[model samples]
Every structure is written in C-alpha cells, then in structure tokens.
Target: MGASARMRLQLQPPAIMAEVERLLAGRTRDIRLKGELRRLFQERSWPRTAKIIRAWMTWVIMLDALTLGLNAVLLPRAIALSMILPACILPPAALASAFVWTKPRAFWLQRLSITGGMFFILMSVALVGVGAGGEFYERHLNIMLFVATTAIIIFAVPLRWTLTVAAMALGLYLFFQLHNPRLETGSAVAATLFFASGIIATVVARRTMNILAQKTFLLELRDRSRVAELADANARLERLARTDPLTGIANRRWMMETLHRLWSDGMKGRDAAMLMCDIDDFKSLNDRLGHAEGDRCLVKVAGIIQSSVRRNRDHVARYGGEEFLVVLPGADEREAAHIAERIRQGVEAASLPNPASRVAPYVTLSIGVAAQAPDDAIASPEQLQHRADAALYLAKQAGRNRVVLHRPDPPGS
Candidate 1:
C-alpha cells in the first residue's frame, strides 16, 4: 500500500513502504519506476509483454516477405534485387531480438536487444524506399514513424526505451532528407517539426500509462493487507470475550453455553459428570491476606485444576467468586470422584499458607462430584449443579479439604 494505506493507521511493512515512496517519487520525475517495485512490475508484466513482442515480430517477418515479392513484380530488376539486401537483414535481426524477449533475460540485455532491433527495422525500411526512389522515399519515413509510435503506445516498456526509439526514428528521417538531392529546405524543416510533435506526444502518453499502472498495483496491496489485519483483530476479540480475565480460564458464560450443548445431546449427556470446587475457608483467607494475594491463590488453583483434568474431554470454568466448575463427559461417579480427589491433592501440595484456616496451615480445596446415568432424573446441567452444590455444602459441614459424592434423597422421604 502507498500513502492511502499509511493514513489508515495500520502498519505497512517498513521495507514495502520504502518501495512505495520511491514509486510515488518516480511517477513525477523521468517515469522510471525504481527499486523493488521496478523488479516486481517487470516480473508481473513479462508474460504479456513476451506474447506481444513475439506476435509483432511474426507480423514484421510476413510483411517483409510480401514487400519483397511486390518489389520483384512492380520495380526494375536492379532495384528489386537491391531490395533483397534489406529483406535478408530484417528477418534474422527481428527473429533473434524477438527470441530474447520471449524468455527472461537481464533487464539491461533486454533493453539493448529491443533498441537495436528497432533501429535495424527502421534502417531496413529506409533502404527499401531508397532503392525504389521517388514518392516511396518520403512514404517509408512515415512507415518508420508508425512503427516507433506503435511500440511507444503498446510495448509497455519504460519511458527511456520509448524515448530511445522515438529519437532514433527522428534522427534517421532528418539525416536522410537533409542530404537528399530532391527535397527543399522549407519542406524538410516543416516535415521534421511535424514528426517531432508526434514523437513528443507518444512519449508523454506512455509515461502517463506507467504512472497509473503502478498506482493501481500499490492500492491493491494495501487492500489485501487490511483484510489480513481485520481477521487477526477479530480472532483476538473472540478469545477475550470467552475467557476469564483474572484466572485466564474459560468464564461462566462459556461454561453455560457448553452445558446447554452437552445437555441437548441426549446420548452424550447420559454419561456426564459435574465437579463443583470451592477453596476451604476462601473468605477467611481473603480477609486475612487481602484480595491481591487471594487473586494469586485463585490463579494458582485454576492452573492446578486444569492440569489434573483429562485435557480436551473435560471442560473447566471459573464459575463465580472463589468457585470453579468442571464438566467431565463419558464419566461415572467413581471416575469423577477420582479426578476431584486429584484436584484437591494438587492444590494442597502447593504450599500457599492461609493463617486463619482450620484445615491445614496451607490452602486446600473441597470438591463435590455429581454424575448422570441413563435412568437418572438429572434433566438439565443446572440440576447437576444443584446436586454438586448440595454435596459441596455437606463437605463444608463435615469439614473442608476433601471430595464428596452427591447422593440423591429417597423418593418417599
């Protein structure tokens, strides 16, 4: 992207920005695109340029053959034979030069071939006209100018090359007519001035075309870069929306959505279990150590709980203040209790001291396990939460720093 991309306040790669700056500066000067942009522009245009150059060469060859036959038929034997000289020179030069353009070559060599081919072609046309004499002499100069103008308009080469072709054609015409026996000074000056005007116009037209093409290329790059940047920003925002900022784990909203999905799957939810975990005497710990240390404890506990689970199969969430929840799919009460016990041990092993706690001198966890079977009456994930919470209350009542299983109340009780 160029200047317009920079204004968007998005970052353009520094190296690419430098190239674009060079391009914009190049536009107003000699119309030669420089640096990395020049190389890329050449590579981009090469295929089409090759085809056009080859086609033009083929046509020039065919036209020269046709002209040789016509000269043999309509002109004197000596003059027709004299025209044979240019025909021999033109085809081989055109063919060799066209071959160079058809494949990739060094830019300097490419320009050299093209400029040399143009001058040879001009000279061959003038030689044919001189052999035929009279009106054909002036007409051949017009033909030379036509060839140069067409190259300027369609070749899509840089301005310097186009200017080179134009200058050579003008120089050839003025040189031949100035030394001519029949042509007058007044007519020669008028003809030269008129030819010079056409030359100037074609060169200016080619310059304008190059500037516009490079500008279009720059804008297209900027648009692609903006699209990539937008996609990355959207991904970061989505991650932030679903994650708990403090604990760096899944939040309550994500947990609820996942629960809804799991419950809706009748077969899958049948073998699911829920573990609701609360730190033993969390409020007392927070009161004694302040919220900063309490937040540190929460983060540490969340990490331990995550590490203890079955990875992708288990869903973990920071449900609310000092409370965490985990959902285990395809698990029974025994398996759920075992995982919950692991979580309890992992936290107690971390030696974060809570002075007010009656359980252990260090912090500890109490987890409640509730599971669903095929025949059980746990209709939704909320019912699982209520059961686990009930069990959690029992664990707190009996004493903290342990795991408890939720046993449903009997039907007749």
Candidate 2:
C-alpha cells in the first residue's frame, strides 16, 4: 500500500474512540472494543476475501485443465499420462472451492473451505511431480512453492489464516522434498529453507496490510459517529433559539419569522391571521404569588391555547412577558374571533387563581384578532401585526377579559 492519507479529527463515542486509539497504538492482538470491532472487521473483510477467491478459482480451473491438455499433446505419452492424470485432481478441487466461495456461507464453513482447499490444491501440485517420476519431480516441487507464494500474497485473510496457510505450504514442501530419492538430505533442506523464507516474508507483509485496513475501518466509524452527534446538536440549538424555555412554546423570534414567511411576496393569495393575547391582572397575580407560580400559570395558559388551535395549521408562541401570539393559516377575522373566544373561555374555566383580578375570581385573557383575506392588499407582515396590536390596545382600554376584532377604519377615515 502507498502512504495512507491522514485521518481528520472528530468526536466519537468514548468506547469506539478508545478502541480506535488502542489499535492505532499498536495493540493489534487483543479482542477489540468488547468484540464490536471483531464483528465489524469480519463484516468488512469476509466479502473482500471471498470476492478475490471466487474470481481466482474460476481462473485456476481453466489453467489447470489447459496445462493438462497441453502436456498430453506436446509431451511424450507415458510422462504426460502420469503427470496429467494426477493433475486432473486440481480442476475438480478448484471447482469445489469455486462453489463454496461464490455463495455466502457461515464463517466457520468459509474458514474450512479456504484451509482445506489450499491444502488440496498444493498437494495435487506435489503429487503431479511424484507421478512424473524423474527430473519433473524436483521441478514440480518448485512449482508448488511458487504457487503457494502467490496465494499467500494475494489472499488478504486474517493473520491467523495467513499463518495457517503459510505453515501448511512450507510443511508440504519439506514433506515431499525429503522423500525424493534423487535428492540428498543437504539439498532437500536447502530447497525447503529457501521456499520457506519466501513464504514467511509474504505472510508478514500481508499481516501489515490487514492491520492498515482495520485502522481505516475504525476511522470511518469515528467520522460517522461524529456526524450523527453534530446533527443532533444543531437540531437542539435551533429549538432553543426558536422556543420559549419557560412556557415550552415558540418564542417571539419564531413567530415573527412565521409571519414574515406567510406574508412574503411569494406567498400571495394565502389567507393568514393572528391573535394577540394578554393575561389580565398578570402583574397582580405575580405580586400576590411568586415568580415560580407565575411560570406555572404561563405554562397552563400556553397549553390551553395550544389545545384550542388546529394542531399543525396554527402556531402559538410566547410573544413576551404575560403575552402570547398565535399564527393561524386560512382563517378569516370571523374564524379568528371564534378561536379567540374559545381561548378566552378555556383560560377563564382553568380557574388558576387570581383573586386580585377585576375580570373574575379566576385568571382571564384579553385577545385581539386581525386577518388577511386572499383578496386584501396587505402591504407587509408588520402592518398586519400593528392592526392586531391596535385591537389589543382597544380591548385593554374597553375592559379586561374579552376578544376584540380589528375592523379597519372605514376607507382611510
């Protein structure tokens, strides 16, 4: 592998970051992240190894059959027959491995297939040389070593699997070489050592590559977890900015934003309305009780207004101290007045205690209503809000607990 790109800094879960740090710190031999890393590595590694093996198996069968045919046609018949017949074992073995790798199977089953199949392929290569009986015997042994070397380099399985394949390949090379009648003890040992050294080097390199891949996987998990955390944080901040903490309702900022959006030029022909509600004798209630009790009253009143309005079509917000604003879509002044009256009755019925009030024994609200019909030439959202504000001033001036609709002064009088 070329130089790895640097991983970026990101916040992740503590347990995952710990595991990633441990692996980066070169502690590769232990169970990772309480077995979570193990499962994740397998999920990523298994399919990659299977794909390489599946493609290789097809090529192996074809090449083995071609070698057998070519040997029969070009070489002497006795030598060819001996070599070709034993080598026939290779094609079917490769086919069997292909069948296993092409389909998904249990982990243990895949392990067995890889381990067992490598042995079969390597042994068949050695047996072909044995059947050839002369100079071909030693020559075929070299071919087997060469084949094993390639397998070790190409199959990026786990370190254990690589070690197992390396051990089996080296053992087979020595076992068959020692039995050769033409070779002396010294030569046999030398040849085995030479091939064994090459296989061992290849196994070490494969292990390094595997570790790098696992480290990359850990980095990916960190980035994904960080992205999730950032998204959740942003959502919460947005809510806090738009919502009143005391009443658990939308704040003035959100209400103004909604009104501007509804009355924007692009939203022409849409009908919208608002209700400006004030708690009558709210100052007296706060002075009589404490601020904590006032908070409770605000929450209760907010809930009442919320329940009275259409769920999604109307938005209720705490406009400021002792006041709430409601944005209603598609409601005329008459529909708005009806909604305001319902809110008035709901708050009066709640009986949240304001003996100091002049309106009644219980808490009361005075609401002002204004609406924009589809045909009306409302200049801006602020103008509509001003109309509602004017209506609220009128209601307060006339009497405390009542709903008053803002009727435009007759034709600019």
Cα RMSD, model 1: 5.8
Point to the candidate with the largest TM-score. Answer: 2
How would you encode candidate 2's per-residue C-alpha lDDT over 246-296 as one tens digit per residue?
Answer: 988999999888877776747542577888999999999888887888889
- Model 1 spans with C-alpha error above 4 angstroms: 1-11, 14-105, 116-137, 175-189, 222-231, 254-276, 307-316, 325-342, 368-400, 403-413
lDDT of 1: 0.83
Local accuracy of candidate 1 as per-residue lDDT tens digits, 1-413:
24543443235577776666555556354435567556666766687788888888789889989989987899889878977886577788789889998788998988988899988988888777776677778787788788778877887778788889899999988877775667987787789889999889988888888777767656555565567679779988987888999999999999998998877766446788999999988888999999998999999999999999998899999999989999998889889999999999999999888887989888999988888855776547888888899888888988989999999788998
Model 2 ranges with Cα > 4 A deviation? 1-34, 65-84, 95-104, 133-135, 259-269, 332-335, 378-380
Pairs of residues at least 3 apart in sequence or in different chains that clash in candidate 1: none
Candidate No. with top lDDT: 1
Model 1: what TM-score? Answer: 0.70
TM-score for all models, in order of appearance: 0.70, 0.84
Candidate 1: residue 328 lDDT (0-100)? 92
